[model samples]
Target: KSTVINALEDLSFYCMENLPFDLIESALDHLTREKNGPQRFAIGIDARDKRFVKEFKNLTEKLRKKFRLDVLFLSSSDEVLAERFSTTRRKHPLLDVGGELIAAIQHEINLMQPIELAADASFDTTLWSPHYLARKAEERYSGADLHRKLQVTVVSFGFKHGMLKPADTIFDVRFLRNPYFDPNLKHRTGLEPEVAAYVFEDPATDIFMEKIVDLHSFLLPAYYLEGKHYFRIGIGCTGGKHRSVALAERLVKDLAAKKIPNVELSVSHRDVMIGQGI
Candidate 1:
């Protein structure tokens, strides 16, 4: 439930966990009537109940007349599940009746087979991290508008924390002057105007920005033509608190100013507060 809930948090959907199979219709009805309520809803169900699987499918079909429905089944290898359970030191819900953990996992898998077959989409999380899984789900659930447009995510990170794997392009800003060397600006983050100004004051920063923006402007349409919907660009420096963040913000601003048709832009600072004292 946490996995599903966390993944959907970034989207506009309102989520309910551990919803009884019987109440799905009621929930949908309530959502539809509310003036300001979210049109998208994510309901979580426990797959351990074999009796509800068929009934749930029936309910989903009935609800489809009223709303768009996309059923996603999430699963993983037994070995991976076992490893997760072992690492977390938590008993499986099906561990009752004196069954071994592996047996319980197998039993649950058997019960989930019907739902898996009926699912519109399925994901195997054996090798996926939670963030990556969330990204995949978001991509899968994005509206039709997103299909026509390229969604660009510009992320700022510190090299010490490692590179962002999902990045389609990575730019290093370590060559810029270090703000950390100055006592007054050492603790400031790039979101602060002073820090941003200091970071962008270098002549090299201007040249770099122009080149990167020009490259993206040239490449974005090509990627769009190739049917690519999402692109993650990474900006990294020694500490994410300063240069990377400033550059990422500026880049997005520049891109937005260009008004690239059918392009959506977003930014995130992944490690901005890593070493902050307060």
Candidate 2:
């Protein structure tokens, strides 16, 4: 619901002295409201100083009744933070207080014993960026226990890169008739419904579609067994300008028509006018 620290100085005495207290108060108030009103508990435990552990523990104890606490404790080694501070050209909290920055960090880590022991999850944030943290949080929160629908993303790409990483299966359309050779349609992408019509004019394309759809219908239930949250089926051609792109768009439409749930499909051309650098 909310976070309550010992004091602003608990993070970095030097750092907080320059920060606006109003902002901190507002954040705490927001956290409190979320915890008490919505049963949402979001708390961050950073052992920047040794004294804040008491307040952190007290806050958790008080909010246990209303909110389900998701406590995250971010830890780092003294050596790592020291190197980071040097690289960033930033002053350490204890540098001006007759204390070694490394010593202060060690002291903080030592004081985190209680919180770490009590944490639901602990992460080493020394080498992690904020983006990575957010992703980790999302992955942890996305509950897989209750009938998680298998997500399928059918992406169209170029053979130049081989395949997209998330693709569970790949289909090649390089052998099919390509629309890129047509001067009138060369500039267009697969998103235009006309492109799809032009590419699917070949009788072989029609046969291939019927088969692929049949195959996918059979494979989806099997894929669910592997705990696959998302499936990216790549369709690639030589340049991805016409065949691959058109096929991808058509695949999404067909999948929709068949009433496939948990399927989020998209089309991409890795190269459209790449040779001319357009």
**What TM-score does candidate 2 get on C-alpha atoms?**
0.47
lDDT of 1 by residue, 145-216 (tens): 334678999999988887778888999989997788878899989889998999888889999999999999
* lDDT of candidate 2 over 151-236, digit per residue (tens): 77777777775556767888988778777777777787766777778888989998998888878876775555443557778888
Error of 2 at 125 (Å): 13
- Steric collisions counted per model: 0, 3
The alpha-carbon deviation from the true structure for residue 103 of candidate 1, after best TM-score superposition, in angstroms, is 0.7
Would you list the C-alpha lDDT of every candidate in the order shown?
0.82, 0.62
Please state the error at residue 163 of candidate 2 in Å: 3.5
lDDT of 2: 0.62
- Candidate 1 error regions (>4 Å): 143-278
TM-scores, all candidates, are 0.50, 0.47
Cα RMSDs, all models: 13.3, 13.2
Worst 10 residues of 2 by lDDT: 1-10
Cα-lDDT of candidate 1: 0.82
